[model samples]
Target: MACLVIHGGAGTIPRASLTPEGHQAARDGLRDALRAGWAVLGQGGLALDAVQAAVVALENHPSFNAGHGAVLNAAGEHELDAAIMDGRDRRAGAVASARYIRNPVLAARRVMEASDCVLVSATGADEFAREQGLDMVEQSYFTTPLRQQHWQRAHEEKAGLLKRERTEAEKHGTVGAVALDDLGNLAAATSTGGYTYKRVGRVGDAPVIGAGTYAANDVVAVSCTGLGELFIRRGTAQDIAARILYRGDDLSSAAAAAIADLTADGAGAGLIAVDAAGAMAMPHNTEGMYRGSVTADGVLSVGIYSDDFAAVETIG
Candidate 1:
């Protein structure tokens, strides 16, 4: 049995702020990711490869916050972060504060395939990506008028120069995927551009192993988004898997509990998970999370808000 689940960050996404076309676009992005992973699984690929492909698709989409459409940092630069894990043996790879590399998730997978290191950061990460012959794009490639406007607005707001506050959707965005392959192995991946106008060289949970990304064949695979610091402080991903492995909790229970822990600490966050048995869970403390799942039984669902969950069903 094989299943795939994905998330495109979480935050306050009021229905009023989303046009029907915009909402459908995000849903289509999720469906594209699901189909991308499903194609790999259909061909008997490893869970790691399936998830990598799925996340790479998200990274390439200009509608999301990773890769080509990443938001600018406080310095008006793009510094990306990404992580991936294989449950079969708990192998993990990550990159942070990276620039020039077009797809950070692909670079992360290369780190797992070639390097002894689990995490690499800053210019060093960029250098490593080059040495590995990964695709590189001009820094301008990541810049969009929307991101530039966001950075300027953030700077102004922080200085009390703007009367209107930014919407919650502008505050955070990330892309992640989790998968179970026919071989009974699981994997998870996450990628992000960090918060709008974040400090350059700032690392986040997206690249922190066991925090935003974790997988175990015996328990669960997890990928998280939202506030990076809180997710790291609570080791969000691993804690969920730990609950399932040690505390004898089921998939949904452990996932909801983990998000609740983050909420209890006054943090906003969300995560997507899949257990060894192919049961999937996606939970968030925010009003909305861009998420989707395709279970082993062919139950395919996607939603931008909790209210949309009950309305979606299997593609079959």
Candidate 2:
């Protein structure tokens, strides 16, 4: 059995706000990620490798907030964060507030493989990436023309609105991947640039293995996207796994329940889960969340809007 899942992000994004081209771009990105994972799984690769490949595809895409086109910080620099987990070994690695590292998730994987530590931060992670000879770039290299325009528009919107503390909820987009490989193992990964105008050194759920990323051979693997603060507060990723392991909930029910709990608490988010059986689920409380999956039966499905959920019956 080989299954893979991906998410663009989860939030209150109105369908009307996305142009047809924007929607197509997101769908294309998801398809690319899914195909990347499928290619690995097709060759009998481990779940961790499949997930890493999938997320790397998203990280390289300009449309998503992960690697190249990530959101800028308060100082107008891109700070990347990512995490990866291998359930079979119960080992994980993460990097937060990192700059200049071209692929944060690969850096995190190196940390997991080379060090005894579970997490590393900013300069330290960048140093590790340098040591490993990963591509390093100036902060300016991360700034995309569309992102710059979005930042300018955000500034204008901020100036007009009376609300001074409007959070990153206003700029909602994240990319994540989860996979169940042929050997019946599960792995998960998540990457993000954090929210727009994020405070310096602000660590979101993306870098926390069990919060933003989790994998368990006994149950499922999960990757989350949404309000980072709320996910940190609720431990969304682990909670979903707990529900599946403790309450005997199916993967889809557990994921849906987790999203429902967040929404009930006024925290918007979305999640992707893949069980050991290659069952998958993606649920969100917003108008749209970019998601796609391949089932154990080799069926492929992808969608961008909330309404697409009804057509993907296997998920829920």
Candidate 3:
């Protein structure tokens, strides 16, 4: 069986805050990502390729908080994070706080195959990207009118210039994909621009293998988003797999428990996961999660808000 699931982010997406146009935009973005991953799986490609291809679609989409449309940091710059994992060998690659790379996930894959290390950061990651001939663009390339507005609003909020409070959607966003291939291999990939107005060098769960991304042939492939601090502390992604592998929990129980664990700790997070048995779970302790999924049946479903999501979107 070949299946893939993906998420744009998880948070309180209030219907009031999302206009019909915005809702449609989010659904369209998810559909685009689904088609991209499905194309790979339809070609009998590996899960690794499917996951990467899916993530790239989100990264390129302006609606998602990744790659080209990433949010800004305190310094008004974009520092992207990404990670990818392969189940067959349990190999992982990641990049943190890199500025120049167009696609941090691609750079991460390069590190996984071309280097001896599993992680890279800062100046070194930039050097690696350049050496690998990864696309380089001026930092402004990541700035969009929408993100610039966010950065300005955050600055105003920090300075007590804006009287309004922040919305849940403004608090978090991330893009990730997980896949199980026809060959029974699993893989996961996650990419993010971190939260709005974060510290310049702040690195979140996206680039942390077990926290935001994990894959294993005997357990599951997982990608998580939200509350990076809590995810890192709890090893969120891996914990879901652990419950399945060690505690005999099914995909549903394990995924729900992982999100429950985070919420009990007074934090919010969400994840999309697929087990070795081809069962999939997308769990979140939030108001809404922008997500989608596809299975061997060739049907695709994408949803934005909780009340509007179809069960078919979660299952197939």
Worst 10 residues of 3 by lDDT: 307-316
**TM-scores of the models, in the order given:** 0.95, 0.92, 0.96
Segments of candidate 2 deviating more than 4 angstroms: 161-170, 309-316
Higher-scoring candidate on lDDT, 1 or 3: 3
- Off by more than 4 A, model 1: 310-316
In TM-score terms, candidate 1 sits at 0.95
- Please give, for residues 1-316, the per-residue lDDT of candidate 3 as tens digits: 8999999988645778777787787888888898899888988899999999999999988778889888899998999999999999999999999998998999999989999989999889999999999998788887888788878888889999898877656765899999999999999999999988998899999999899999999799999989798999999899888899888999999999998889999876789999988898988877888899997787787777676666444323
Q: TM-score of predicted model 3?
A: 0.96
Of 2 and 3, the candidate ranking higher by TM-score: 3
Model 3: residue 214 alpha-carbon error in angstroms: 0.4
All-Cα superposition RMSD per candidate? 1.7, 3.2, 2.0
The reply for model 3, stretches above 4 Å from the true place, is 311-316
Clashes of 3: 0
- Candidate 3 overall Cα lDDT vs. reference? 0.88
* lDDT scores in order: 0.87, 0.82, 0.88
lDDT of 1 by residue, 228-311 (tens): 998898888989888988889999999999988888988778899999888888888888988988877667788888778642
lDDT of 1 at 41: 80
